[model samples]
Target: MDRHDQVLEVWREFIATGKISNEKILSPAIMNSWKRSRECGVDPYQKKVPVILKEHKLKNLLERNKDLIEICRPFIDNLYSFFRGTGFVAALADVDGYVIDVTGDKEVLEMTSRGSFVTGALWSEDVAGTNMIPIVLRENKPCQLRSTEHYCWSQHRMSGVGAPISNPAGQMLGVLVIFGPYEKANPHTLGMVVAATHAINNYFHVRRMLTESQISNKFQKTVIESIPEALIAVSNEGYIALANENARKRLSLPENITGKQIRDVIEPGNGNFLSIISSKNNIMDMEVQIIQDRKPKHYLLTCNPILDAEDNPTGKIIILIEIVRARTLVNRMIGAQAKFSFKDVAGNHPRALETISLAKRAARTLSNVLLLGESGTGKNIFAQAIHNESNRAKGPFVSINCAAIPRELIASELFGYSEGAFTGSKRGGNQGKFELSDGGTLCLDEIGEMPLDLQTTLLSVIEDKSIVRIGGREVVPVDVRIIATTNKNLKEEVKKGNFREDLYYRLNVFTIEMVPLREMKSDIALLARYFADKMSARFGDELIRIDDDVISILTNHSWPGNVRELQNVIERSISVSLTNVIAVDDLPPEIRKKPAAIERDVSLKAMERQLLLELMQSKLSKTEIARKLNVTRCTLYRKLKVYGIPYQ
Candidate 1:
């Protein structure tokens, strides 16, 4: 029988007997769908196609499947172009089998719209009964439906081909359908729909990967930028691939240096950063120098290799830090920090209290400070205390002894010299104390001992706030607070032509006289106890106690070396003392003999009086009497005159 006659016979048999005896007259796919439609209680004589969603509901469904609809739009448009004259309408439906979008011949769309076969129409087997969209969605496969295959009579003249669109994981997302008249239907039409849906799925997979890559790159860039240290990433080929904001600023690099060779940017000389990329081994804390504005600055470099999935080196990451910052870190680790505040000065003697009050006031100003005191008085301690209490407390406190350095090299030591400025000069030159102490305090200990000529240069530096290196012409400005300590009387030296008068006056702007230890005798016991406690920690023992007799001896002896001498005596006593309590016997020989020395001075005075009295009685001449007394005539006459005896 002809195809129309066969379709008619199957329809009639299924309706009359509630089953189809002519199942062999149709394709297995179509027969199976027809049976499913019948089991779903769909009638072959039904006239109306079900509307799944209208207006607002349809808009909401389209919005929910927006990604699927967008991915299939372009592919569906191209498919429609190939079948433009074939009366086909390309439609996309959600996995629920509701038509979300349709595009095709205007006349064919108009006919489908009248039968509720357009957008928002339900085409599921249970709703519209046996259509390509519903059947493809149900079976999760491609399908072809001929005219008589549709269970509803209203769709008897229509043919549709559809395929379920799925993601990379093979989970169905939606269906792509192409519908036209039954006369134009072919197996190839279904193949075309299946191929188009595959292309759309590929687009979805690629787009998802691109999105994830973008998110990952953005997160990486943010992390790199947030780091405080300079960071650079170099490719295996030695070209810079990425640099953070800190790296760019530190290297003085342009906004974008990607793909530029590392040597062109950093000019690695001693660091050998490129070797790390090849060796794939990490190198840390390597000191490297880079020249900027014709002067070299030091930086510590750390390089770590970036490896690929195969465990082979792909690139290297570089971290850079200025040597100054590294030095600060080292200083902290070694306890070179300025830990003493004004509270640590430890004394209530009026002179000591007054000195502390003056120091605390000086700590608030930026003027130069001149600490005048005898040796061993706590000048260095006061210097550090002033620095810690100042606004620049966080900065470094660099101290250099003027008397310690040789006169010949003191000039270069105070003001750095340039490269090749002198023999034995560092390759990149060196930063002087002034530069090193920038934003901090520089204590010039024993400032009186500074040479006469260097004082003139120092005066100029103080006036100008800048220094020219001994061998170089570059003028480096420094922001350092000068705290000069001197044991000698600068005024006397200036008068004696041994010091520059102008420099002396300039440094004496804010003079703080550090009280001598002997004058503040009341503080001796307190300071002794303090030093004993400190030495105990170093000696790894319990705190040593000072006996009252030892304190009395310490107070009685002349501390010519000031507080420093007391500390030394205390430390010596602790070392020799067999017990934890320091006694008078543990005192140094000089301190132990002080009382005898005082008694001996009184006896010697009485002996001299008797000897001079006897010499006058013998009637010796002034010269003879002076010679007998082992003194000069002037000294002997002065002694006789002060004693109220005859000088003649």
Candidate 2:
């Protein structure tokens, strides 16, 4: 029989017997496909191919596999070009055997369209019965099928070659198939399909690797940008590769400084990153200087080398911290913060209350403040209280005593000098109180003792809101609030040419006069108790109590040293006292011997009567009073009874 009659005979035998014993008549691949088709119950006589997906479903499927379609489109078009007039059609199908793309000549397209072999057609074994697309998908290998090898009778006139397309993981993604009339089939067509499928799989692998690399680069950039310290990464040749936000601001670098030489952006100085790179040694905490806004500023630099897999240095990562910021942190660690507030100023006397009220008002503004009072009258306390109550409370509170720092160094101490500006100047210079107290308060204690020459510079700094160091020409701007304290009257000093008149008016913009302990005698008792309790804790004793007699003596004495002196007396009394109650005899001789001023008056008899009446109201026993007055207990009781003071 001829080929056509033989194909018909084989189909009839498989339908009737469910087996094929003719191995020489058909290849092993075809015989196996025939067995699978029979077990699946496909009818060899079935003619019409069922629609697998309607228009909308087909559109959705194509959209879902858009990447695969895109990757296979040009290859399919090339395959069609190779067989342009040969009546061949090249098609691509997913692993499920649904044709997602097709390209072919008009006549071949029309011929396949009739049998639903066009795009969106289902060609699986269960649907189309052992076609090339289904067999290739099942075996995940390349194969060719001709004429009667197809199980369905309708596909007996077609021959096709198919190859599986797989991802990098070796799992089959789809199949590439070229189908045409059996008369046009070539032996090398299946090899071409196999080669094209590998090219498609390679494209998938490369595209996935590129996508993952882009994602990883973006994540690394994000992490670098989130760091707070100024960070710069440079190539081994010293060209910048990356920089963080703080690095941009601190170095005043322009955006997109990448690939620019590091030396071009940061002026070379101590801890030069390029030098460190040459040495190939990691350096840390190296002080350096950079010129920012035409002014020299200091920074602490740390650099670490980036090494390649071979352990050779490839790049460097540099970290920069502003020196002023480091000093501010150090100051905080050393208790350079305001610890007192208005509530800690223990007094309700009218003068004290008025001073507190004025300070509170001063805290609301950014004006300079001048605290005028005798030493130990809480001038420093009021300054700190104002700072803690102000909007800048969270910032540092730097106090520098003008009298403590020598006149020759006061200028350099207030406005830092540059390197080589003076003998013994620290390397990279120093940031003075003004720079250290940026965005905070700087208390210039004992402003009266400031030299007349320095006072002139102070006036200019206050007027211009900037300062030039003693030997430096660069103008450094400061945003510090000036809080000057002095025991001497600045207005009087200005007249005597000891202080500048312009600076006096500037600092006196908001003046607060602290009340001395003697002037606020009513608060003396409360202050004594407060100090006693504080000292008791320091002495590791029970909270000390002040007797009424001791209070009376404290109220009567002339406290020349103000609150500070009173605190010392309380601490001393607590240290020496035999009991927790501070008594008249526990007091220092200087305090005890200093009798009430009224006792030395010419009207001694009246003063004595007033003293007796005052002592009578106290909680002190008669014996304590006798010891305090330097008289016998019998005399104390007789005098109190004579003054008509109650014995109780």
How far residue 374's Cα lies from its native spot in candidate 1, in Å, is 0.7
By summed lDDT, which 10 consecutive residues of candidate 1 come out lowest?
Answer: 597-606
What local lDDT score does residue 156 receive in model 1, on the 0 to 100 scale?
A: 75
Report the lDDT tens digits of candidate 2 across residue range 51-73: 56987998998988898899999
**List of clashing residue pairs for candidate 2:** none
What lDDT does the true structure give each of the candidates?
Answer: 0.80, 0.82
Model 1 deviation from native, Cα RMSD in Å: 23.4
Clashing pairs in 1: none
Quick one: best TM-score, which candidate?
2
CA lDDT for candidate 2: 0.82
What TM-score would every model get versus the actual structure? 0.50, 0.52
| Angstrom error at residue 293, model 1 | 14
**Global Cα RMSD, each model:** 23.4, 18.2
Model 1 residue runs over 4 Å out of place are 1-229, 233-239, 249-257, 260-336, 537-540, 593-648
